[model samples]
Target: MSLRPRDMPKLRDQTLRHLDDPTSNLRAKTGDENATGLDGLASHLRVGGLYWVAPDMAALAMSSGSQLAAARWATADRPTPCGLIMFDGGIGHFDARGVQIPIEACAWGPYEGECMLWLLMSRRRLVAEMARANLRLDEEQAPPLLPVHGFTVPVTTQPAPLADLDPSVPLPVIAALAASWLLMQQPNLIDRTRERPDKSVRRSYARAGREDPEVTVVDLRRQYVPDTADPDSGRDGRHYRHRWVVSGHWRNQPHGPGQSERRQTWIESYVKGPDGAPLLSTERVNVWRR
Candidate 1:
């Protein structure tokens, strides 16, 4: 039920070996084309938003050659400049018989910019552990199978230092702390759905366990042009010379006893344009959301 501190090193090593094994069935095509769709999904991530990573996305990340590429894919389309990103999904790896096995895992980051920490735990292991601990979840709620420890990998070439986390502390504690932090953000639930052409079909939320989940696109990013007639004729008689959407992100705020500790705070997306004027950048992003 609880992870022992002494076993953390062994667990970390085993996880790394499994992930780096060359004979594993986690390989994926190494090219821009294969990653384009995954990149599109990554773009929809909003600060404090939850996404269920698809198999393709997980496979791409597990591929040895696509580490850097996968890293780029995760941060490519961000709702904000920077903050915590969370996702849970199945990671594929080969067993002794060369059979691909799916491992359930959850990841959180950009602890040190462009770095993600993953907690890998098999579904069987999770179920066994929960049974041993006599833990139960409501029928409508998803299982909370967060692992006790995990391994960290760089999502980008130049990753920031892991200064926020203390190595002396147990990883499981850190993971629990991160989960609590994420919950405090009140993360938005990202729904994945496909539009029915008939339009008469009622929506259903039951889980069918599909590998490639269908997702709907929601464009929150819009281009804003200032009014020429009256530069200051906008809301509250205030307008900007340039208008642009500022993506939502997270910020660190001092908190806890004596304010000795810091916590992540969510910053909502907003428009930037002082006086009604022209737009700054014509480039726009095709953001996909539930």
Candidate 2:
């Protein structure tokens, strides 16, 4: 069951009306509490050498999942529904100190940033969803779905050797695959499309297993689903456009002589569309029960 669209504003108002949190000095969106945690997260990422900071969302805007409309959710801001995907194994909540705060995802919603839930999603679940839709992060976007918002980046195509490792492919490749998959999965009223699949990427390949496995590929890309749409996609004619990000690591190892081996390629791209932004059947937001 979900809440009606008209009631969303009321709910938001109700949530914001009360701000007296007796648990800790932390008030929602003050950015102070999350700031500390974000600091901890930053330090952790820097030491781990996962990827670059500053320019990326890991350094830039931080917020909760699909629920929050805005990107930046620092301090005392309207509580953005948040889920912590820790650097260590498992998805669990973390304290301002960046320590894991044991909690259920079901519990994550109601609590503001001060007490957000960090969850570790199952890779198995992701695989199953992909399979259900005949979607493979590895394969190219089957059809109907194609890039919409991004400009094309042309690279002379070449055949990959048999010795080439997949390493979950490259980041740009991951983005393309994910964009197509996510768009197709998004619900449409007219076309009567499917609901958004619950997908999460495990960035830590080591925890994901198989490090430097010459033959096997390790998919360590972390992606986030941002809430957005083309103004026209929605009410214009009742169309829907779903957007998402795919990030991961890949290294193309030159099989033998004449082959050029590249360094760790941390590729990421923004992908969207079903050729045209598919129209939405309805704009009613569903409020599920906790």
Which predicted model would earn the best lDDT? 1
What TM-score, to 2 decimals, does candidate 1 have?
0.29
| TM-score attained by model 2 | 0.15
How much is the lDDT of residue 270 in candidate 2?
28
lDDT of 1 at 88: 30
Candidate 1 per-residue lDDT over residues 18-67, each given as its tens digit: 33333422213233442332222223222223333333323322331211
| Alpha-carbon deviation at 55 in model 1, angstroms | 11
Please give, for residues 1-290, the per-residue lDDT of candidate 2 as tens digits: 32221222222212222222323222333346454433332232222211111112211111111111111112211122221111112122324254333211111222222322112222333444578789865321111111111111111133222123233222232232222222222232012111211122122334556232111111222333432333223355543354433222232333335665332122223233344544344445332111
Off by over 4 Å in 2: 20-290
